[model samples]
Target: MMKIRKLLDIRERSIRYGSVFRVLGKWPYEPLVDFLLVYSPGCDRKSNLVVSTGHKAGLIMERLPLESSLEHGANGISTKWAISNWDEWIYPDCPIEDVFVID
Candidate 1:
């Protein structure tokens, strides 16, 4: 089990589904603690079901049930996921703040 880090910031957009977050600490494979936590909002309300990283246009990686736990805060929920393969989990773009709203 990897040690979960505190969430430094969150990047949200008007899409109303997925959100990206930056953590304080780093993981095994990932040099940076940035992650894309995706979930269903309406009925499922499955938060942090899909954890991913890397550029949205380039190769993206993902993990299930984000293993690492996060520090509780008002900005957003704290959660973490283990490092997995560079699977096909494309998101909008990095520095999500530039493209998405910081919520």
Candidate 2:
């Protein structure tokens, strides 16, 4: 059987300006794909129910494994790669919206 690996855990970095901490970096992009799929009709309709359901269910069921992997120093999944590699999983003919923005 193939071994499944978990994506990276969210990390935080403090933003400092000279003498004061001003901002913090957040993992805002990690769930962008899931959000897009859930909200966008074109993407949602084209998505495979079984695959999406299984993916979500697996995430929950494998939480312990995922956390363990992160504790053991696994790298997080790349948002850039996920965005750029849509064609690998999504059908070429599927109608993908040109714009997706989260407010």
Candidate 3:
């Protein structure tokens, strides 16, 4: 796992769900770290579900109940889907696969 060097700053607002912060961390390039930071702004919006970076993929795989069916947001699906698919802004040039530890 990549070690976060420091949390540069944090901001909180109702629209942002909770704490929003800039963290400094080592990546192969500075842009990669920047890319990882983009997800912070997206935390506030409501959706069918929220998947975050620190939620380990292994934990998700282990705990997700098989009988449950997730109700995806049909009306706000586009914007919600965009959140799932879009890369964060700090490293606009870095590909998503290289930035977030989870896909």
- Per-residue alpha-carbon lDDT of model 2 for 5-101, expressed as tens digits? 2111112221111111011112421222222122112442222211122133222111111111112322322234333443354222222332222
lDDT of 2 at 61: 13
**Candidate 1: worst-modelled 10 consecutive residues by lDDT:** 79-88
Model 3 regions lying over 4 Å from their true place: 1-31, 34-84, 87-91
lDDT of each: 0.32, 0.22, 0.25
Ranking by TM-score: 1, 2, 3
Predicted candidate 3 versus true structure: per-residue lDDT over 35-73, tens digit per residue: 111212243433322222342211111111111212442
Residues 1-103, model 1: lDDT tens digits: 3222222222221212344444332334254444555543453333442334433222234433322233342222332122211122222233333222112
Please give the clash total of every predicted structure, in order.
3, 1, 1
Q: What is the lDDT of candidate 2?
A: 0.22
The candidate maximizing lDDT is 1
Model 2 regions more than 4 Å off = 1-50, 54-75, 90-103
Cα deviation in Å at residue 96, candidate 2?
Answer: 4.6
lDDT of model 2 at residue 92? 24
